[model samples]
Target: MGKSIFISLPVTDLKVSVAFYEALGFRNNPRFTDETAACMVWSEAISFMLLTHDKWRSFTTRPIPPSTSSEVMLALSCDSREAVDAMSQAAAAHGGTVDINPVEDHGFMYTRDLADPDGHDLAAMWMDVSPMPARS
Candidate 1:
């Protein structure tokens, strides 16, 4: 079996966070979802566990970062630049912030950043590997 990663994020509201993630193309796996957490599945190997503040504290002694600060930025790869843009729009419409960063276009790659309601940072990116310049 291939390895998998479970990214756990501290969310203030489980339902809203689940909806926010769903708008960004993640599906909830009911088997691991409840009032305190939602298992948002991006793919077979990538899943995010959106946990409530109390639940999150149980796993770590570190204080939760304020909404204005970011501890990490999670990036998801899209099949096309249009897909990245679509996700950015969806994020905004679903109560997330899409103005965290400017849309970056570098010929072979494009990307944009978004912030969830709880201010968890996320990025959507698309790359055209066929157009990548060869390394020296």
Candidate 2:
């Protein structure tokens, strides 16, 4: 069997967070969703479990960071440069903040970073590895 990753995040508002994730192309898996949490599917191997504050605390007593602070950054691969840009636009249109860091452009890859409404850092990127230089 293949392994998969399930990222758990604490959100202030369940519905809004779900919508934001959806805009970025994640689909809600109702079988794993409820009033307190939602399983947002990005692909066959990737999924995010967005949990309400109370629901989050049930699993850990660790303090939830304030909206202005970030502890980690998540990166997603896009099919093309246009897909990366589209995700940036979608993020801005939603409650998310787009381009938290300046855009990065290398000949083989392009990236744009954004932050969710709750301040989770997310990076959308597209890369062509064919031209990448091999390690010495």
Candidate 3:
């Protein structure tokens, strides 16, 4: 079987988190979803398991860090710079907070960052792989 990656995150509210992700165009995989968790599939190989705090705690001894005080960030890639902007805008419309840093235009890459309702830092980025001058 092909290898797969599932990023499991502890969410304070399952329904709210699910709705936020859905607004970002992700689909829920019912096969792995339940009252305590929701499987959000970003792609065939990349999935996110939004587990309730209690269910998440069961898998670890460390305390679940409050989202507002956490430092972890999750970055997701898009197909183009426009897409990065679009997703970030969608996040803001869905109650997510956009970081103060202005959108970055690196010529070959573009990026914007946002924080979800749970205060999880999420970044939307795009890389232009077309031929370009090498950086000094």
Clashes of 3: 0
By lDDT, who's the top model here? 2
Better of 1 and 2 by TM-score: 2
Backbone clashes (count) for model 2: 0
Error of 3 at 28 (Å): 0.4
Which regions of candidate 2 fall more than 4 Å away from where they truly are? 133-136
Whole-model lDDT, model 3:
0.85
Ranking by TM-score: 2, 1, 3
lDDT of 1 at 16: 89
Off by over 4 Å in 1: 133-136
Q: How far does residue 65 in candidate 1 sit from its true spot (Å)? A: 0.1
Candidate 3, residues 35-71, lDDT tens digits: the string is 9999999987888899999999889989877766757
Per-model root-mean-square deviation over C-alphas: 1.5, 1.3, 2.5
TM-score of structure candidate 2? 0.96
